[model samples]
Target chain A: MDYQRKYEKSENKNIKKISIIKYIICVIIIPTVIFIGTKLFDGKKYAFLTAVVVLLSCVPFIISFEKGKNSTEKMVILAVMIALSVFGRYCFSMIPHFKPITAITVITGIYMGGEMGFLCGALAAVLSNFIFGQGPWTPFQMLAWGMTGLIAGLLSRYLKKYMVALAAYGAVSGIIYSMIMDIWSAMWQDGVFNIKRYVACIISGIPTTATYIVSNIIFLLILARPVGRKLERVKLKADIIEKD
Target chain B: MNDKMKIFNTYHPLGLFIYFASAIVITMFMINPVMLTIAIISGIAFVLTLTDIRTFLKNLAYEIPFFILIALTNPLFSHNGVTPLFFLNGNAVTLEAVLYGLDMGIMILGVIYWCKCYSIIVDSEKFIYLFGKAIPKLSLVLSMALKFVPVFKRQYRKISDAQKCFGYYATDSYFDKIRNALRVFSCLITWSLESSIDTSVAMKAKGYGLKGRTHFHNFRFHIRDLFLIAVTLFMDIVVFTGIGTDIIDFRFYPKITQINLNAESIAVYGAFIILMFMPAFLEIKEKIKWKYYVERI
Candidate 1:
């Protein structure tokens, strides 16, 4: 019994190490590969490629790590999440008052972990651009939105209860997301990055940023508690099914 | 039927290489707008010869109005040129400005149409196969997204119809229509979300994105692809020669030169026109084959 326990602990430690390595790969290596690929390949086609790749990479993580009891039920939940992540942006963008991706990302982060949250943000950008049609700038949108999801997930851990902290992080996430996207635009469109280009991009993004801040706060206020409770209920229900 | 269309479709690396070389040549040589216009026209003509008028006309019908709107608006907003056409709200709209707008509008349409043609003729599977290993995430996203559209549209239409049958009227009233659209959108979004998740799960189970990656692709590159590359390079050389000797030009600004219409320029324009209609050409070929099969039956 003692020897078995020791082996289990070592196996667990190895698994944890692998997971950490994956986290590093996802947050750093993937982006670097995308960046270098962008520089070498034709810009427009490459942008489309990046968006697709990011979405594809998420498949394994989503499939293997899910805690759902039934495969069909698990699939149905994921589908809803993906739909909300992707088309939800378009729906909100049309409203003229709501920022779709930011709201979705924050909500998703609060519900799912940072990893799933990040995928939601990035996939939303890629899917939304289909309606806008693919272009030279789609990858920037993916990067920006993906980061928003990542930040929201990270911030959720620290700002677990305080509404003010939640709201502040949401607002900051919007600004940072836009900034990251515009950095690429400034480089590609203007062929240089400077204060002038930054100003131009930021000025255009005001309405979007405003909507994001408002939507995030609204979503946090209205949906967070209810969704959290529902999530708890879902876990309980799953537990019952598993015991059966 | 000749090499140019084949070059554009199968040998994209070669096409890209040619693009870089010509871009360098044009920039370095300071190619005149007139000469560039000639070259662009020739390229269009070549595209046209491969395809037909129907496809070009279709794109023109779709894109012209939007292009015109952009072109007209730009000159009104930007009054920086020397040659004034009229005064609008204390702004002098110049002939140069108007011409520039029109020129830009035409260029934008041309590029859009060219891209459309490229999408139509180039086998998307081939593109995915070529770059799948280099960028798996992108390839997967693009393939899935492209695949999603047709499925999405079909499902959306069916759901909308079902809703209508269930007394959900999608009316012309702005607010009501928007509401209706949102309902449909949300439902579709839900469906797509589920599909993507399932797909991801399946991919993962199949050992996708594994540390030791094994890719699956069935892309076939044939003798035609090689020929296409060679011919495209040859045509690119011809284009460069035209630009280098001041026969073709590309410029943007106050200097508007009259286009001297020559036979070679006309031929080049013809080539470009052929290139633009590759889709129509393929469709026609398909139809012809079907007819032949039917006759045999």
Candidate 2:
């Protein structure tokens, strides 16, 4: 058991080291690729290339799951979380622009760690779109939701402790989602990015954004305690802990 | 399944995936109005061949309003172009902007139709097959999630029904209804969490993620799949090189350029149309052959 603990400690250190590289790729490499690719390639090639890059960025998170103990259990928990999030979206389908996907994603991050949260969030977007119909916006949706989960997971320490902070994070996530999607809309509108058009897109999307914010806050307030507690119990039962 | 063998249906999953991926990428990148028109028409034809007239019309019905909204909104926000059509709030609405917007709208509509067609062709099994080799863990989780969605939905309904029998959800007020829904959702989370523990234990008992774990594959790449792949790659090369070399140049902003019609450009267009409607053409050919065979009999 002592040797097992020492091995896990080393693995945690290695993960920490590798995660910095992942951050650099996600933050620096991806944008640079997009910027350079757009400048060099035509709209079609650029769009395809960007989608591939975004999908590739998810590899680190997927790989990170293997470094932990009880990988199968972690995977099962993630699948269940993704399924529940998708089901949450369906439950609120009657309400226009109101969804619990973001709130659920944020809570998942807060409990299961960020990498699992990111996976769940990203999977929910694609899986839900299987029923909602997919388009060019699918990649953008994945990135947005994935980032939401990542951010929530990164801030899980604080978010788990405070109810108010979690709700605030939920509202911010809604805005971020709208903003990312608006960028896609603007890019789709004109082959090039036009500021005036992007601004107009945001303005037109204000109502939907408002609904997102409201639904996120409402859902987070309602779900964080119950769902978060249940997730905590699962984590305890599985004996999975976030390796420092 | 063996009763009617169409080319697309007979091809390897990889070949089918390549066709749709290349088609969608090329369609989205194309800015030339002429190319877009060809794509839209082929998209419609593909939809018709794949499904039925009802589904084709339904897709178009869903797309038209979105098309109009995008086209109309472009003229409102984008005031770029040479030919001014009118002035709204001191902004010049140009014919070019409207036309540009119309092109974008058509592109989006075409892409959406193509994606819908793609979904019909590529089921979750095919998707898992394509990615499963590279990311075994992720694929397993994805397939599991796919399985769980229907299960969760049924569970939700059952739980809701059980609750309703106990008068737990009998509230008439909107707020009360929302509260009751939240209660049902909370219950679901608890149930799923408990159930997941059982699933994980079962999976572990099966020695999942063990070393040298072998996966079962039903798909095999035959000689015909090779031919299909070669043909698609050739078409993709032709189209991409044509676009790369400016042989199929098109600009939508400032002013719409007249499409240059030459042998190479026409060839590119033909290649694109064929590639875009490859599956549809195969299905049509099969239908014709079946009719002829029936008549001879």
Candidate 3:
């Protein structure tokens, strides 16, 4: 048992080192490359920007999965949650622009950890688009949802305890999703950043944005406690990570 | 195995992916009226050839109004052109803006159609096959997520049916319905989460995530795939050059530019048309060949 404890301690140390390296890569190296590439490659900046965003988005999952003690179990849980989120979107297809995907993603993050949340959010976007149809807007959707999950996971301690905070986060996520998408629209419209056009795009998207916010609030308020409780239970049962 | 040899299905997944990606990138970037028209027509033809008549017509019915909405909305926001068609809220609805809006609408529809075709062609299997080697864990998670969608849906249906049998109908009061729905959802969460433990255990037992693991792959890069890739690359290069050199450029803002129908522009248009219509043309050729051979037999 003492030897087992020593082995586990070494494994934890390794995970910590790997995570630190991943953070540096995700936060520093990727953005620097994108900035430099944009400056250096005048003709292909858009492609370069997209490639960077896509690559950065995967870092969380890669780091988290590698760091976790029971990586397979953690992956399975994340995969299941993402599937649930995607299915939730389909379930709400009768209502226009009303989906529980964001809420589920946030909940996944709050319970599973931020990295898992991001994975759930990003994968949910890509997978749901398989049904809804893919477009230039897909990457934006992925970013928006992935960030939502990541933030929720980061703030899970405060959020898991307070229903109001969870609801607020959901509303904010909805706005973020709409705003980012509007940026995409404006860019697509003019092929350059025009402030007037972007503002117009934002103004035009208000109604849908409002719906998204309300639906997010409703879904989060409804799903957070029950879902969070169940997920926590699963994490414990599966021994996904060592106890703090 | 015999199904793999069909023209539309024959190319290596990577080859097909490159073709679709290049096509989409070109279609989205180049907003030339001629190019947009070719894209829309070819997109429609491809959709029709690939899907049944009923599905094709259904898609068109959905697409046409969406097209109109996008085209009509653009003129409202953008008042760039010189020729004023009408005044809306004291803003001049310029002819250029309307025409540009129409072009944008067509481009949007064309991209959507192409994306639909892409989804049909690149099933989850193909997607996993392409990305699995580089990111095995991610591909595994993605495949599991996809598989879980239907599984969870089925479980939800079963749970709801069971609840209904116990007189928990959603037709009750709004609050009651919401509560009951939440109850059903929570139950699904518990059930699925519990089952995933079993799944992970089974996977671990099967030696998943271990070193020296080998996987079965059905995809093979044939000579035809190489030819397809070469042709697609050639077309993309020609189109990109034309765009880069401003030979096939069109401007809508400030004023609409006159389209040059010169030899270079025509070549650009021809290359785009060929690229866009390649799938539809191949599918038709295969259909004709099958018909002729059957008649001879």
For each candidate in turn, the TM-score is 0.55, 0.91, 0.88
Find the 10 residues in a row with the least total lDDT in model 3 chain A.
Answer: A40-49
Is candidate 2 or 3 superior in TM-score? 2
List the candidates ranked by TM-score, beginning with the highest.
2, 3, 1
Ranking by DockQ, best first? 2, 3, 1
The prediction achieving the highest lDDT against the true structure is 2
State how far residue A94 of model 1 sits from its true place (Å).
8.2
In terms of TM-score, which candidate is strongest? 2
Candidate 1 docking classification: incorrect
Per-residue error for A167 in candidate 2, Å, reads 2.0
Calculate the i-RMS of every candidate, to one decimal place: 7.8, 1.7, 2.3
Candidate 1 or 2, higher DockQ?
Answer: 2
Residue B290, model 2, lDDT: 84
lDDT of 3 by residue, B73-102 (tens): 787777777899889899999999888888
